[model samples]
Target: MKHCLVVDDSRVIRKVACRILGDLRFETDEAEDGAAALEICRRQMPDLILLDWNLPTMNGIEFLRALRREHEGKSPVVVFCTTENDVAHITEALGAGASEYIMKPFDREIIESKLAEVGML
Candidate 1:
């Protein structure tokens, strides 16, 4: 099964995402912040990352930049799942190497479609 890392500060969001991804047949991991997420990646990079924008430490953009600098970091498809829904935010995320972007309040259908769009489904 493919592995997925869900990085979000909110426990509820993480739980929801984990459940959805699990139903989608993905082996899942959770991280409460970007720093923690990065540590997880260092140990074992996941196939996909569901990242949040505002985190306790390192933040999403910082984590993405740092991850892209790491060996094999480019291999995992980073998908920004956040409340930041602006053209500039989207542009920056895309430029920073995110494969896709998802706004806040997402459901299984949205996640499924995004996964399919990124060829993860």
Candidate 2:
């Protein structure tokens, strides 16, 4: 089974994502902040990451930069799942190496489509 890391400050969101990914047959891991997510990444490289924008310690963009810089050829596919719905935010995330972006209040259909778009589903 593929591994997925769900990085969100909200416990509800993390649980929701974990459940959805689990249903999709992915082994899921949760992180409450970008720093914790990064530490997890260092220990175990997940196949995909569901990232949130506004985090406690390190924001998603900063984490993306660090992950890309450090992992390079081995970086996981990062999909920004956040409330930041502005075009600029989406552009910035994509430019920063995010594989995809999903607005908050997403459902399984949305996640499935995103995974399909990235060829993960």
Off by over 4 Å in 1: none
Off by over 4 Å in 2: none
- Give the alpha-carbon lDDT of every model: 0.94, 0.94
The window of 10 residues in a row where model 2 has the poorest summed lDDT is 68-77
RMSD of each: 1.0, 1.0
lDDT of 2 by residue, 1-121 (tens): 9999999999999999999999999999999888999999999999999999999989999999999999885358999999999999999999989999999889999999999999898
Tens digit of per-residue lDDT, candidate 1, span 17-67: 999999999999999999999999999999999999999968999999999
Q: Each model's TM-score, in the order given?
A: 0.97, 0.97
